[model samples]
Target: MKVKMILPALTEAISPHWRPIKYSLFPPLGLATIAAFFQLDDEIVIQDEHIEAIDLEDEPDLVVIQVYITSAYRAYELADYYRQRGIYVALGGLHVTALPEEASLHADTIFIGPGEDTWPQFLKHWQVGKPEKVYVSRERSLIDLPKIRRDLIKRHLYLVPNSIVVSRGCPHHCDFCYKESFFKGGKSFYTETVDRALEEIAELPGRHLFFLDDHLFGDTRFASGLFDGMKGMGRVWQAAGTVHAVLQPNLLEKAVESGLRSLFIGFETLNSTNLRQQHKYHNLNRDYTEAIRRLHDLGVMINGSFVFGMDEDDETVFDRTVEWAINNGIETATFHILTPYPGTDLYQRMATENRLTSDNWDLYDTRHVVFQPNKMTAEVLEAGYLCAYRDFYRWNAIFQSVSTKNTWEQKLRHLIYAGAWKKFEFLWDLIIRAEQVNKVLPMLESVLDGFGKKSAIAIIA
Candidate 1:
């Protein structure tokens, strides 16, 4: 038997704001993970469209295509092609789970939730016969799962080939969070046993490991045990977590001692009212500035994420958000236009109010305006988003942000890391298109390396 697992290029890839370096940073760990279910004797192929063009000319017994909201159309096109040629096609991922009715139209078998449990079921059915048209996930089991088939990954193609996901979903469901709709049935948040997670870490070959978990600190016991085990691992890592997790006593310390170099925090909106509007209770009343100070004090670089075009946002929101980020000396920032992805409370609310301007999936990339704004027009929102990114990454802005660092090493790291992040896009495009992303890993690691013994004893203040 021959199997082909593909991760189609997501909507962001084709967007005007798309950058090759961003997508080239992580390979499709999801596809490689599910490849674990394939029989050893079966020939397997894994492809990430972000890294390379997919070969639609191939014939395989089973074709598995991971579907994301932006990549839904491309996935459907590929699935239709394979199905027309009498090959079996399976569709699954965040988008498929939320919009199964639409996805079912394109797939011979459509998995309606996380595939950790459903993929094996599909394999069983495929061994004897065709899989059912739909399989909804009713379980959240991450314990002792077969190690992800990392061997199937072309690690050299990705800047962070060591990216991993030890947990699933998040504990707090903001109104706009996709996890709320993705895991509608069973346990929404779960993690692997501490021992198992440590084992995966131990097996990963590198000095840098990125925990791709939505919230690595979701379970205190699991997180502590995992971090304790990693004390001497000599690894520098990164992950995303809520402000609530960062403010938790002792948890942030444990993570730092385990070599957590940078963290992504969703400081979505500054206004507390918008927090209530979006049901982001975790961030409500949390001291955003104090959180930044704590992470800086612990030598953890910050990648603050902000969402714009909320109900309370006005034209000044863009410059205000960017200014706040720079004032706090955030090492990096990600700005979004408050994309209300389908199957979220945000989407339902907008649809109910008849504010959705477009149902075109392509325009839902967050870089585009898909819904009407309250305090400002859609054009104002879109223009503001672009201005935010432009203002934040300017040469002057990088210098301003870097100047806030305490030590020269910290300043240099921020300057190099943040500067190269956006300013060197042309070079990154060249390197990525030429399939030489591996060549740039050492440079990234060097910046991470600067977060060394010095950071442990120093505080920016």
Candidate 2:
């Protein structure tokens, strides 16, 4: 039987400028791993609609879609389309895991947890013509499942062929985070027994690795052992970790020695109040300048992440954050609007207070505002985000940051990202203007309806 894996984008209409981009740079490592589960008798094809259009003419026996909250809408649309064409559709990933009932409306079957242990059973059931509504695994730890097939790696693009997971689950229970709910009781992680993980990494010809673990250094001993095992492999890798790991000078040096070139750190916010409120690990109260300098001195490029729209944040938060990034010499940073996903604590609290704007999952994309704010109107929050993006990616700011960074490669990456930022500037401006014209102005007018025109204009301004 033929099985096709379809990876849908966050939207169907690809901006003409975004089409030529290659998939390897930010490939869907999750769906690629699932492709390894099928047998030789089954024909497997992978389609990423973000880079190329999906051609349904090459029919398959079954269609599987992997998605996250951002891409949930596109996934549903694809599922509905394929199901109408008589294709058996299956949905998996964080979005479906959090809302199976909502997902089941579009899919014939939805896999709740990790697909490694449940996918084969799903396939077996499908072969017998008895597909179930939901396929779930109670396994709390990462099982020693099959490694991704290296032969399936596409060489034309800048993709990491050898991707592996060293651990799973996080202990940090941040209010605006889904990890807190996904692994509620406690943290859980399972390594691939050092030798096996090393062997898999060694087998890949690309010599570049992408560790999908949410936190690579969640366990210090296991992380150190994994680093030691990777020595002399002539491989360069990148992984996500908490600022606590980055602060450990010795561990940071050891990781550099083991060919670690880039590290993604969840700085979350520059505001100490927001950090303390969220209970984020690492000392947010510490001098961020010193912390960033320490990592840069160790030759590790830091990809800092920040979230906006916390209760403590106000209009000034945007300029303050941009200034922080510029002063710290942060190379690449991702700024996301706060999203309260269904299973997370933030979601429950907002729902209880009746602050949720709508149940439209499509708008749940981190870029949009889905809940009412305590401090500022949604328009101010939205405008702040766009202004921040514009300020950081301005030509002068980009040049200053790139020149300050240590290496030429680092400078080039920053330049490329800055160019991409310029292209998306229009979209960011549209989001800001839309909030002001459609929501903010109308609501303010309603509140000042009885007041004089002069007072209403003053209030708006």
Candidate 3:
């Protein structure tokens, strides 16, 4: 069967007048992983709309669309478009998993939960013209899964094209986390074999890899075995994990020795009350300074993530968090306004209180504030989010954070990273201006055309 797989982009990301220059920051691993399950006879075409245009003119037997909450509307549009042309459409991902019925209205078949088990079954039935309306997977075993078909991807498009997923789901089910809904029962699972992971890494072209796992150290036993297997591989990687995992007995040392260069930790809030409210109590037990010091001592850079607008937070949260991060020599910090995504506990509570401002999925991005805060206004939350970013990326903060680096190269790299964050803010402003121009361009063009026609008439006269 001829199949076309799509990784839909948010409308704002693909606007003619306002597209981001750095659209292909990451390849669509989800689509590629799904593509890996297809038979050799299946002629497949993959399109990542964020990096390139979708060829709507292509005629395929089936269309597979990956859905994210921010791209839900666009995914629905693409599904409807392909379906109108008599193509079978399959929709799956976090968004569809959350609202399968709503997605079913647009696609021929919708998948709930992970596609590892359901996808192959659907494909088998599809070939015989007996595809089901919904396919659901209840498997928790993360063994014997096929390696992602990186050959299907245009690797040159992504900044870091070489990546792998060693684990799935996260144990810490924070109130605002979408993982709680995506993973059935919010259970974290690890790959049964480290040999398969090592084989995948060996096949890849690059020495540096990025593990797209929700949390690499969520399961210490699996992590320890994986790290021990990776020790002699001579490959460096970065992944996300909790502070508790880093401080685990003997695991952190083994992980670093195995080439874990950096980690992204969710130090969500500085306040203990906020941590409890978010159900991120694990973060409260460890001193933030001690965690940062230990990670830095292991020659690993820290990418600390923080969120504003928790019930126990006030405007002071931003400055305090930024200052703490800078003081502790954090390599980088990502700030977010508290966002209540669909299918999250926070969203349910906000809906019950009638505090949700809108169901606009586009605005659900972490940068936007969609719900009322308990202690401060939404405006204040938004402002604080911006302030946190600006302060963290400021020159003084960057210098302070890099001062502890042992080598000049490390210091220089951190400085460059800080500058990149600053430039990102500029790029954001440029997009907004481009959007404004997009809104008025048609009218401007019409006026110019009228003026040219009148000028031609005068010349004829």
Candidate 4:
């Protein structure tokens, strides 16, 4: 059988959220993971529309397209085109799982959740000439699975191609999280065995690994074993974890000892009411400063994440959050406009309250305000969101944030990582366009080494 898998360019190329370096950072590993289920002799090809143009003329035996909210329209058009040609097209991913009924309208079949078990079942029935119209994933497992086809990844095309995901779903579900896209009242959290995770890490050839897991420390035991196993791997890596995880004793030390130089943490709001309102109880009563101090003590440069336009947010929310982050010495920060994704609890509440201003999937990327804000106009929410980024990433703001660091090394690393990442878009765009991202990996690693050199430490008081 001949197969082709495509990840459509998200947010349309012209949308304001579109960033060349963001899309170019990693190849579509999901496609490669699914490709592992196919027969070894089957002809397979994968294309990331962010890296290369789709060949609409190709006629493959099967085509699989991954869809996200921002890429739904592009995915549907491709699905419709291939189906019109009497070709079988399978649609899956977040958007499909969230709105499978709508997705089914464009394809021969739609996968409703993680495709691990469902895809192989589809292959069996397909081989027997009786494939179903829909395949819903009921059992979620990460044990003894087939090797992910990393050989299929185009490493030269990505800046951080060594990305891996050892787990699925986070232990704590925030109201705005996309985990609901896959959960559907089913089990969502699972992890690879520590041995499997370490073995996977050993298979990679680079010194820097990006853990794409929603939360690397979600399973404490699994994380401990994984970190213990990685102690001597000589790797520098980045991953997202919760403030609750950072507050746990020994785990932060183990991760840092295992070469965790950077973390993406969600410090969504400064207000505790917002935490309860969003069911983010893990962050409630936790000293946000203690978490930051611990990570900084271990020399971890943070990419603090904050959401704007929540129920308790007002016109000052953006500036207030940005100022707090700057004062806290957060190396870098990500700001979102608090989108109510279609399948999330946030969406259900908004829908019930008649606050959903638009049902357009494209506007749900968090870069746009898609719902009615309780405290401010949608226009103000959108403007504040943009201003937060501008204010946080400005040269003066970068220098100000670095001052929160205790050591000159930490300060220097903070400035370099945070400034270069957001400020050098032209250089990044050129590097991505030329497909020479691999050339910069060594520089990234050296800079990260500096991030892990903090001279002081702190604990929760």
Candidate 5:
């Protein structure tokens, strides 16, 4: 059997947003991981549309496409194009898992859960010419999964080419999260063996890696062992976890010693009531200041994630959240509007109340306000979302956060990263206006040159 596995660009047509920046930022690990599950005898070809254009002319017996909410329309187009050529097409990923019925219109076969469990069954059925319309697997059996087929990846295309996942799913069941819906249950987590994890890391080409877990320290025991094993590797890494997890005794200290240079924390809302309403009760009593202090003290730069448009949020929410992040010395902040994806609890409730403004999957990217909020109009929510980005990432705020806090190494890292995001905010324009990129390069160089000679221990020059 011959296969073509793809990670589609977010739209039917290419744009500056994906072509020049987003594609280079990360490799399509999802497609490559799924490729690992295919039999060795099956000839496999992979293309990440963000990195390269799709080859519709390639004749393969099977084509597997991963779909995300924003990429659904383009994925459907790809599927239709392949099916028209009489090639079998399979669709999976969070978007298709949420709306398998809609996805079935495009794909000859649809996978409803983790592709690790469903893909093999599809292959078995295909061999007999009895391909099922949908294969659903709600099992939580993720141990000893095969390592990703890194050979299939175009490593040089990604900014962070070395990526690995230590775990799958999160324990917390946030109402708006699709993890619970995809896994068919909340409060379940799965991990590969620690030794296997280390082996995968050691084999990768670079010293810097990204552990792609939604919550890296979700299982404390597993994390402890993983950290212990990683301590001797002398590599720098980053991962995401809940605020409460980092506060555990000696866990942060050990992780830092084990090359944990950065963390992506989901501080979804500053309002405690919004946290509770969304069932993220674990953050209820935790001190946000203390959490930031501990992480910064350990030299771990934070990529704080926040969301607006919750039920408790209003016009005041945007400024409050942005100001809180700035005052807290957050290195980088990502803001989003509340997006209730299909098949999640939040979507059901919003649908029942007739609060959903649109069913367009493309608008569900969190950059757009797809649902009506109880406290503000959708137009206001959209405007405020963009405003929050501008407020947090403005040049003045970026300089203050980088210059005034953290160690020199952390400061340099934060400066370069924050500078890149500021450029990204104007990337679409930068493409059309050639002079824009030229103007930003010198500013970025000045920032970097100022800190390059300083000692790592120096907090201020």
Candidate 6:
């Protein structure tokens, strides 16, 4: 039977500034890896909807859709469209894992947890004409799976190739983070023997590598060994990690000498109280300014992350964060509204308190504000988030950050995308605030009235 896998885009609309208009496709790593599992006789096609329009006329016997929360709506729409044509539809990925029942409405088969173990079983069942309603396996360690097939990834998707994952799970239980749910409360780190990781990198032709690990240097000692192995490979790499990891002097030096170029660090909020309450990794005694300075001194550019909408946050939170980022010389920053995703602690708390505004999956996008806030109205939270983005990516701010850089190319890329960031913030504010004012304000006011007043400053400080 003909099988096709679809990787939906984060959004249906393309941002010309962020993505090259001429080349709009991203390598669907998850779908590409799944395609590798098919046998030689099985005809498997991979479709990235972002790169090209979906050709429903191809008429595959089976269709698999992989989606994240940002692309949940598009996945549902595609599933419905294909199912109507008598195609068997299966749903998997982060969104499906979070809300299987909601996803089941559109899918004939829904797979939760890691797809590696369950996908092969499901395929065997399909061959026998006995596909189950749902297929789920206990989260498998990455060490159990074979090296992901990079050959399936189309060359066009690689501005810089050589993506590999060294770890799977996180230990932190951040309120707004989905990582806590992805691993289901347990920490799962897969140590793919240093020899194996480096061997794969050595074989790949690209000089630039992107480690897809949630955290690359998970265990400092293990990371040092990996760094030693990576030295001979002669490639520069980038990956995501926490500020705590970067603060370790030995790991920081090893990362820099081992060719680490950029690191994505989750600085989440400037509010220390919110950080502690959420159980985020925060060193209360250490100076954050000093930590940032140390990393920059080591020549590693930080892509700092921040989230707005904790009970402690107010209108001034935006300016405070912007000032913190600027003072520390953060190379790049991403600001998001706090989203209470299903299966997360924050989601359960909001649901229990009846602070959830709607069950619409589309509104759950991290860019939108979907729940009632304790310290401020929904309008204030939405506007504050937008203002934060605007203020951070303002022309002067971008210019200042980029000018401090050594290369003109880096400065140009920042300039090219700055306008798009501003537009995204403006559009997000309009949609989120309007939805709240028209539909959720009354319900929110009633809840807040009964909850009683407490100092927002005291909570966030």
Q: What is the Cα-based lDDT of residue 164 in candidate 6?
A: 67
For each candidate, what is the lDDT?
0.88, 0.70, 0.78, 0.88, 0.80, 0.70
TM-score of each: 0.96, 0.83, 0.88, 0.96, 0.90, 0.83
lDDT, candidate 6, 1-461, per-residue tens: 78888988766244643443212313677876677667767778877765556777888999999978878988999999999999999998888888889899999999887666778888899889999999876756555455555665655533333566665665555776675665653334556667776766778774566787777777676688889877766566678888778777788787777778678888888778888767685444556777777776666667788988888888888899987786566766888888998888899989999999977776776677799987888898888888877778777887776665555443443343344434454543443333321232222222212211433233223
Q: Write the per-residue lDDT of candidate 2 for residues 313-400, one digit (tens) a residue.
A: 8888889888788767776677788888988778988899899887787777677789897788888888888888788878778788
What does candidate 1's lDDT look like per residue over 225-264, in tens digits? Answer: 9999999998889998888899999999999999988899
The 10 consecutive residues of candidate 2 with the worst lDDT sum are 443-452
Candidate 6 Cα lDDT to native: 0.70
Clashes of 3: 0
Candidate 1's TM-score reads 0.96
Per-residue C-alpha lDDT of model 3 across residues 316-424, encoded as one tens digit per residue: 8888888888988787787888888888898898999999998888888887888888888888889889888888887888898888687665565566555554556
Better of 2 and 5 by TM-score: 5
Steric clashes per prediction: 0, 0, 0, 0, 0, 0
Candidate 2 has which clashing residue pairs, if any? Answer: none
Number of residue pairs clashing in candidate 2, backbone atoms closer than 3 angstroms, sequence gap of 3 or more or interchain: 0
Number of the top-ranking candidate, with lDDT as the measure:
4
lDDT for residue 303 in candidate 1, whole number 0-100: 93
